[model samples]
Target: MFKTIKNDLPASIVVFFVALPLCLGIALASGAPLFSGLIAGIIGGIVVGGLSGSKIGVSGPAAGLAAIVLTAIGTLGGYENFLVAVVLGGIIQILFGILKAGVIGYYFPSSVIKGMLTGIGIIIILKQIPHFFGYDADPEGDFAFFQVDGENTFSDLYKTLKFITPGSALIGFIGLGILILWEKVLSKKGKIFQLVQGPLVAVVVGIVFYAVTQSNEALSISQSHLVSVPVPEDTASFLGQFSFPNFSAITNPDIWIVAFTIALVASLETLLCVEATDRLDPHKNVTPTNRELLAQGTGNILSGLIGGLPITQVIVRSSANIQSGGVSKMSAIIHGFFLLISVILIPRLLNMIPLSVLAAILLVVGYKLAKPGLFKKMYDLGWKQWIPFNVTVLGIVFIDLLWGIGLGLAVGIVVILLKSYQNSHFLHIEDKSNGKHRISMTLAEEVTFFNKGAILKELDSLPRDTFLEINLLKTRYLDNDIIEILEDFLYKSKERNIDIKLVSKRGIVENPSSFIKFFNERPKSEMSLS
Candidate 1:
């Protein structure tokens, strides 16, 4: 990890710039203390990054958990009481890690996962539009279709257009221009450009822009449109910002309910992010999922004890880390330290940077994730993959993150069942000289209850004067439900005057009186074709 510091240091700075506003925005959206978001960011980076198996994944306050945190805090009676639930949730996540529940991440369909990344990308782009124009009504990092402020995503954009801050819009455009030039033109020119990332340049330019325009009433960006970090007057007051959990709240049954909910949601979001970050990793490194969960659990526990919102492996920060050329976990750790040091020493300076600058940086990140090429790529994969992928993206855009994933997963499962039903058996029809129809049905390699419907349909469709051959020579396992279907079909075969030949690895039997008895009594070698 130390070997990559040359690359990691620069990348960490970029991630710090990216994570700072997000940490505050998510906290603002959650109705939690703004400083709590910074605490989660610090612990997520230092503690989780140290213990996690992921080289690129960065843990922090997740936008995905904002809604949950907001509601839980209200339900728990107070922010201090909510801290109790967060700590308990962390404990539960640790137990989940111990039980190796991280394997659940693998069960999600690839299409859905990709859809999630693309969906989130689109959401980022849409949500940042208002902020990019300096519309400060809706908090940054709130990605839900319906916002807590009673304004929807599109309505906020409309409102932003009506009340655009000239100073903010001007700086936002300048910041965007600098970022584009840095990436597309300047970076290739020299090492200096590469070391000094586009975002850092944009931030510096934004600060200068704000300072220069301060006296101009129409051009000056307001405090609402700037980065807001809690300014501590002295060291003691700075430390005073951290709050301890109300442990007595643990006795409340409601606290445990909230705890379990947080544990479940945070663990799921972390697992999904782990998978996404691994996919986004240029080196194709695979993260140990269980270890990630354990690390996150520990981070959440620490964060809660110190008055922080819940922590998860957030895709936003992780993606920013990867895109900014983060090569190791050190980048994440360094970024955490940056957050710690900046808040302590240069918070007022940080507060001077325009939110529009960060919005510009995130706009680029969002574009990368939801590039037009991805949609075309998914479409070319065929409906089996594309439908679920499209549904997931749409669901995430129109609804919330978890619900979108669930909707996509449900669609993916349905697609799998359809494929299973279709591939269960292959039918080949033959005509004999006597006008009798001969149908040969070959069972799939593995037969389960999902195949029962397809098999029964073919059996029931047999003509009155037909010969049916059911072949299972390729089958490895057959479900009891299918076996029962086959048994019941035998009685139907008699009424239809159909002669049945059941062929298996054991042997062949013709018009078996009792299908079960024939299979049970016959030895593999002794059975004869008759």
Candidate 2:
């Protein structure tokens, strides 16, 4: 970790810039006091990052959870009561980690994971467009289709035209230009260029632009368009920002429900982001999902106890870190320290950053994730991959992250079922044997209930006086449903004069007695035939 400090330090700075506005914006979106978001960010960076098995994943307050936090706060009676849920949620996550529930992340199809990354990319670009042009109507971290501000994603883009700020737009354009130059040109020029990242320079220039043009009314960036870290007067006041959970609420059934909700949502989001970040990592490090859950759970527990919102492994910040060339977990850990120090030492100076500048940085990150090239790439993979990929992207863009994933997964499962139905059995007909029509059907390696229809169709279509040979020699799994179908067809075969021969690893049987009884006596649901 120490060997990568040079890369980690600069990457950490970039991640800090990317995470700052998001932390505050998410808190605001959740209707929680703004400081709570910072607390979560700080803990996520320091505690979660430190504990996580991932080399590049960064954890923090996520926009995905903003709606849940907002609704839970109100429904649970107050912010304090909600903290109890957060705490319980953390405990549940820990339980999930212990139970190895993180394998759930692996069940997601590759197309869906790619779709999630692309969808999030599109969302970041769309959401930041308004902020980039200095229209700060929607908070930074609200990634949902419908926002807490009562405007949908596209409507917010439309509204940006009506309320654009000249000063913010000017600095934003300059910031974007600097970032492009730094990435495309300057960073290639020298080691110094690589050491000092473009985002930091862009942020510094944005601050200067904001500072120098204060007297120019038309060009002055307003405070409303700046980073909004809480400015406490002294140590006591700074400590006062922390809020403890109402432990008494632990007894409330409503609190438990909220707790389970937070745990489920936070764990899922973390797992998904873990998958995404691992994909984005240049080093191709695979994060241990169970360990990630454990880290996130611990972070939430600490964050909730200290008056913070729920936390998760956030993709935006993690992607920003990766894009900025972060090579190790140190970057994530250091970014947390930066959040802690800056909020305490130079919050006023930190507040000088224009929102538009951060928007420019995110615009680049968004474009990288949702590049147009990925679409054709997915398309070339064929419909099996493309359909689910497109479904996930559209679902995310139109609905939200989880909805998109769910829809894409549903589509993926359907595709699997269809393929299964089509490939359940291989039927071959031979020349009449002993003056009787002969048919051979070989069951697939794994035949589930989804294949029942195809099998039934073939069995029903067999001609009278047919000699049917059913082959299960290579089959490893045969669903009980399919077995039942076979048993039911026994009577029909007799009436149709279809003499049946069953062949399996257990050897040949002429018209087996009771398929149900045969399988029920086996050691497992799936046949372990050798």
Candidate 3:
């Protein structure tokens, strides 16, 4: 861990800048007190990072949980009321961890996971477009195509086209230009650019531009362009910003519903981040899934208790961490410190940085995630890889996040079963010379109930005047459903001139006992005879 810290120091700064706006944006989107988002970011970084076994996974306030938190706050009558559920959620998460539920995250297919990252990348790009144009209504794309206020991404973009602010848009373009310059030219200049992060430069330039443009005489940047951490006057005023949880609202069924919602979403988002972050790690360190859950669970509990929004291992921050060259948990911890120290030391300075600068940075991150090359690479692998990947991406882009993954997983499962079903049901038909047609049903190595439909379909379609040989020589185990299917087919075989021959371990059974009785009476060796 210490060695990783030394190697990833540069990456940590990049993650810090990337995470800063996201923390505030997600907080703003969640409708919780602004401090709650910062607090969640702090805990996700320090606490979750400390406890998480993954080398590169940076934890924070998830955009995925914004809807849940927003709904929870409203249903609970106040943000404070939602806090209790968050704590409960954390406890439940810890219990989940103790029960070793973390293993569940590992079982998802790689294609599905990659699809998820790519899908999220596209969402981030779509969501950030509004903010880059300085439209700050919705919390930077909380996973819906349509907004609760009835203005969705497309509508918002249309609105931006209709009413673009001159100052904000101009500054936004400048910010984007600077970022591109940093990434393309300046970043390649070696040690100096490595030492000075691109986002940090964009943010600084944004602040200087804002400070100079404060007066409307020569330059007029509106409020929409600025970073929106609520401006508190003094230290006591800052502390006054906290929202107390509604303990009475804790018993409300809606709160529990919200809790379950948060838990499921946060867990899934965390798991997805864990998968994506591990891939991005330069060292290729594999983090323990159970440990991550426990860490996130604890972070959520703390966040809820402190009137902060729910936290999860977010991919935005994790990807930023990886791209920034973060190699160790230290980058995570350091970024948390940045979140904590900045909120306390320079609320005024933070308020000066434009949302456009952050948006510019995210645009870059988003582009990297959803790059054109990724599609071609996956497509080149063939349909088995392409179908699920594209399906997942399309599902996420058009529908909700989890729903997309679910649809993809469902497709993947169906594909697998189709392959298995096709592989298992084997039939050989022959027209015999001596007024007999020989047919053989050679069962697969292991035949389960899934093969019942295929087997039955083939058998039902068989032509008349066929001699059937029931071969179970290669079969190690037969499902009870299949046995019943075979028994019922025997009566059907009589109708078609299908002379039946049963092959088993004990040479050959001329007229085998009843399906159940034969299996019960026959020794294992006898049933398995070749």
Candidate 4:
């Protein structure tokens, strides 16, 4: 892991800059103590990173869980009560890992996964717009369409025009310019430029800008629009910030319910992030999904013990890590250390950095993820892929993260069923021969119950005085539902004056009396000609 330290070190700094405000913002969004988010970030990075098999994936307090955490805290009675749930949730996650349930992540369709990444990118872009203009009405970690502020995603954008802070907006543009310059020009010029990332530069400039303009009333950035890390006056107060879980609350059934909920949701979100992060990695390294669950479980347990929010492998931080050239788990561990050391040593300095700079950095990240070219690429894959992709994207924009993926997955399943229906059988018709219409229907390989409707519909549509040939030579395994349908069709064929012939590898049968009995007498295990 240390072999790539040169790359990982720089990437870790970038991720550190990215994760800082997010930790604070998600905690704020969850209505938990501000320090709790930072704690989650620290534990997610160090503990989870140490145990995880992912080379470039980063874990943290996820924005996707903000709503769940918020309600869990209130429903459980208090933050201390909520801590018990988080710990239990971690245990549940560990069980999930031990059970080897990580394979469930592989069931998600590629189209849905791509749609998820694109939707998140678009959300990041939309959510950051207001912050870029210095309107801080919404927390940076609130990614849902409906917000706790009662002003939804779009409404906040409309309101931004009325409340934009002049100083923050100016500095935001400057920060964006710096990032763009580094990405498109400066970074390409030298190894030194690559070592010192653009986001780190923008953050430094933002801090300097805020410090210098503090005296100018018209240009001074307000504390409200800056990163808000809780400042501890001394060691005692700092240590006091940590809260312990209420063990008495463990007996409460509600705590168990909340714990199960967190375990399920956090595991799901982590699995999804692992899938997406692997796709984003330049080296295309595959992370052990089960190991990731175990790592997250351990992180959440430690985080809960110390009064922190629940942890999950976060796509935003992971993607930022990969894009910034992170090649090992060390980047994640280093970022956690940065979070811990900074909050302990220089939280005051962190508070001075403007939020607009971070927003600017996210805007670029968002753009890269949702680049217009991806739309065309997905579309070119045809409606089977395009419909689900678009549906997922729209659902995510209009609803929330998980819902979007769910909607997309639903659409994708429907598309698969439709394709199955069409491909179940190949029907070829010939003009009148021997004073009768002739139709040949060939069943597909491995026909299942899903193909019953299509086959039945075709059989029912046969004309009177038609000669129908049922070809099962290509079919390896025929579903019982379809066999029943074919048996029932025998009665209809006689009534319609339709002559029937069954063609198979065994032999030709003239209007077989019983489809089931015919298959039962033959070799059942291997139905194919070969």
Cα-based TM-score, every candidate: 0.95, 0.96, 0.89, 0.95
RMSD of each: 2.9, 1.8, 3.2, 1.9
The residue-by-residue lDDT of candidate 2 on 410-487, one tens digit each, is 999999998888999999997797779989999999898999999999999998999999998999888889989999
Task: Count clashing residue pairs per candidate.
Answer: 0, 0, 6, 0
Instruction: List the global CA lDDT of all models.
Output: 0.91, 0.93, 0.79, 0.92
For model 1, the superposed segments whose C-alpha errors exceed 4 Å read: 433-435, 512-530
Evaluated at residue 353, the lDDT of candidate 1 is 97
- Model 1 C-alpha lDDT per residue in residues 1-530, reported as the tens digit of each score: 89999889989998999899999989999999999999999999999999999999999998888998899888888999999999999999999999999999988998999999999999999998888998888888688999989998888878987988899999999999999999999999999999889999899999999999999998999999999999999989999999999998789999999899999999999999888888999999999999988999999999999999999999989998999999999999999999999999999999999999999999999999999999899999999989999899999999989988999999999999999999999999966747679889998888889888888888888789898888988877666688788888888888888888989877888888877675556555543322
Name the best candidate (by TM-score): 2
Segments of candidate 4 deviating more than 4 angstroms: 497-499, 505-510, 521-530
Candidate 3 worst ten-residue window by lDDT: 521-530
Tens-digit per-residue lDDT, 1-530, candidate 4? 89999999999998998899899999999999999999999999999999999999999998988998999888989999999999999999999999998988998889998999999999999999999999999998999999989988999999999999999999999999999999999999999999999999999999999999999999999899999999999999999999999989899999999999999999999999899998888999998999999999999999999999999999889988988999999999999999999999999999999999999988988888899999999999999999999999999899999999999999999998899999999999967888789999998887888888898889888889999998988888887788889889988888998988999888899888888788778676765543
Off by over 4 Å in 2: 433-435, 510-526
Deviation of model 1 at 271, angstroms: 1.2
How well does candidate 1 match the true structure in TM-score terms?
A: 0.95
Candidate 2 lowest-lDDT run of ten = 521-530
Q: Across residues 102-210, which tens digit of lDDT does each residue of candidate 3 receive? A: 8878877778888988998898888888777777677653656656566776776777776666666667789889878888898798878877777788888888888
If both were scored by TM-score, which would come out higher, candidate 3 or candidate 4? 4
**Model 3: residue 223 alpha-carbon error in angstroms:** 2.8
Best by lDDT: 2
